[model samples]
Target: MRVLAAMSGGVDSAVAAARMVDAGHDVTGVHLALSSNPKSFRTGARGCCTLEDSRDARRAADVLNIPFYVWDLAERFRADVVDDFVAEYAAGRTPNPCLRCNEKIKFAAVLDRALALGFDAVCTGHYARVVDGPDGRELHRAVDPEKDQSYVLGVLTAAQLAHAMFPLGDTEKTDVRVEAERRGLAVARKPDSHDICFIADGDTAGFLRGQLGEAPGEVVDTSGEVVGSHDGTYGFTIGQRKGLRIGTPAPDGRPRYVLDISPVDRTVTVGAREELAVDELVGVSPRWCGPAPDGVVECAAQFRAHGEAVPARADVSDEILTVRFSVPQEGVAPGQAIVLYDGDRVIGSATIDRTSARAASPA
Candidate 1:
């Protein structure tokens, strides 16, 4: 089979491309240029879209004796991922840029281009697995729970999964590093990037300020009492506890969390931490990779990456999904992805539209 490996100048992707060569599949390496300026965010421990990273990927491909090329998708990335992120935040929602990159660039644009060029599949270093199921190709969690990325990739369409390969799904990160070391790969000891790839200095508020300009607003409590002032309501997110300039202390001396952000009114509402607990979430633009399930189903719902999935009952109507958790979850934010899972398999995912506190049952 012909495979096009998306190399990100990381140890995992280097090892993935190497393993593909070892498996006797005809492989080609491609590095995506997502950032307009590579040096903009290359300070420390950053990943991908850097000149050094592209060099690392090219070097790895050279060592593996495979064809390599760099594809520039900066314009598309800016339009689809970065702009969308800024827009969501401006609307008082927190967007996950990684999930957007996977859905728009990796799976949609890159995969489509590869398939059009006669490649049978596009491979990546994502720690997720595709398995044969009763209905069709099923997406599952990686063997390495610590590095499972199925939550982000849950938005992929069925057709995308059919032509995608995750070579590092079954292997541990430690082993991947070991293999890269054995191959003398340059990224063997490279530290993993932890911050947003496009945002330098890791200042989300500053980044948003630069993008949306400054809109001074008032910070208030749940009772509409002004507690402090902020440059913009977009700088704050639901459930954020710190950085709030509220001078007064709560009665119990506990910290307050942001319970609501009204972009229309340009006001942020703060409340006690207890108000953060939510039992129901409504998701819009839901996408099912496979067939949509019928009737009510009990499953796990994840509101954010690296969060534990909570048991919930999901109701699907058209493209809208509503999840009622068995237990209330804290910090459910809008614009984040809500991935539904049945055990290890990803059933589907959607963008969170709103969240509400559970209503009381009749006595």
Candidate 2:
């Protein structure tokens, strides 16, 4: 089998490509140039896909003695992932760029191109397992829970999973670095990338401001009293607590969290932390890993990438997914993904659209 290994200039990906070579699958390493201006994407531990990362990937591929090439996907990434990210935030929803990258760029674009070029499968260093279940190929959590990345990959469909490979899924991060060092790979000591890759300095608000510019707005309480002001509604997200320039403190002396953002009216609503809790979620653009569930299925829903999975009942109808949590969840912002799981197997994923909290009883 011919395999296209995506070497991301990181320890995990280098090791994954080496394992593919050792397994005797005619392997070819490809580094994705995601940013046209690589210098702007940051180097070192903070981010990835920069000029330095591409060079590192090439050197790693040379060490493995595999045919190497670089695929420039900057335009596609900007249109699908970067642009979508800013638009989602501008519309008052928190978008997960990692999930969007996996859905639109890696799995969709890369996999399509790999297959067209006659590659049997596309392999990566993602810490998620692809198991051949009785039904078909199913995506599962990695053995190393601390490094598991299945949440961001829950957007993959059945066909994509069929031709996807994660050679490092069962290995720990420490062990992967050791293996890379043993294989004479320079990136064995490379620091893992974190935060948004495109935002080099880790200042997300500042980056958004540069793109969307300043649209001064008022921060009001739930009762519609103005308490503070902000440069733009895009700078705030649901459940954000700090950095709100409120002139007066809350009457209860407790910190206020952002409860809502009306981008249309440029108004941000603030309230107590308890006001952020919601028991119900409605999501759209559902993508299943295997078969779609039948009617309402008992499952667990994960809102954030590393967030705890809460037991919930999920129902899909008319291409919409609705989940009811047994326990109310907080920090569930719209435009984020709601990934459903059956124990360790990924059931499906959907982009959160809205949420509802049951009315409180008169105390």
Candidate 3:
């Protein structure tokens, strides 16, 4: 089958494309140009979209003897991912740009274009699996737990999963590097990209500030006592425990965490660590990989990347999904993804809208 591999000039993707070639599938490598004006990329213990990365991807494609091209999605990326990220922050909510990129750019836009051009599927180096289940194609976490990326991909819809391919799902990262080395690929030793790719310095706060400008606000405690002042409420996120200039010390001298960010009042509220625990979350814009389940369904819900999945029940109502955790979860933040799973298979996901206060008594 003809497949278009989304190469990001990284070792994982290079090896993924090579593996597809080895499997006797017709493969084409395409690097997504997320930024129009190239600058010095920051790796920050992770990989970056640098000129070197594009060269590395081309080299790998050449070694595999496959056609390679760079598709410029800079404008779309800025609008769909970067701008959305800034806007979410300005609204006092933390947004995941990677998830947005996967949902809007990779799956929606790129997949549509590929299908129109007669490609059977669009492949990527994402560390997630897609398997035929009882109902239909189901997504699962990668074999390698540390590198599993299902969280970022939970936003994919059923139609998107139909033509998506993840060649590195069952393979380990070490083995991928080995394959790249054996294939004489130059990116075998290339490091993985960490944090947001467009944010060169990993300064999310600074990036948000630059986009939204300074909106000075007051930092208050749970009791509405103004403890300090901040440049903007966008600079803070739920469960953030550091960089808060609130001069007051906790009773035990432990740091306080941001419990809530009120964009309407331009205020950030801090509380003790205990206040971060949440037992229920309400999500908006739910997307299912397959058919939406009926009534309250038991599933594993993941709130953050690399975080553990907690047992939960989801009540889907059109565009809104409400998830109640079996156990109170700490750091449940609004605007983060709440991905649902049935064992290893991904059921669906939603963007967290708000987290309800813990129940007075366990039901």
Best by TM-score: 2
For candidate 1, the 10 contiguous residues with the lowest summed lDDT are 40-49
Question: Candidate 3: TM-score?
Answer: 0.96
Top-lDDT structure, candidate number: 2
Instruction: List candidate 2 segments past 4 Å from native.
Output: 40-45, 360-363
Error of 3 at 15 (Å): 0.7
Q: Give per-residue CA lDDT, model 1, range 124-197, as digits (tens).
A: 99999999898899899999999999998989988889998998999889988888899988889987766788
Residue 347 C-alpha lDDT in model 1: 93
Give the better candidate number (1 or 3) by TM-score: 1
lDDT of 2 at 266: 96
Assess the local accuracy of residue 183 in candidate 3 as a C-alpha lDDT between 0 and 100.
83
Backbone-clash count (model 2):
0
Worst 10 residues of 3 by lDDT: 39-48
**Model 1 ranges with Cα > 4 A deviation:** 361-363
Candidate 2, 185-225: lDDT as tens digits = 99989889899988877899999999999999999999999
Local accuracy by lDDT, each model: 0.89, 0.93, 0.87
Instruction: Give the clashing residue pairs of candidate 3, or none.
Output: 47-192, 47-193
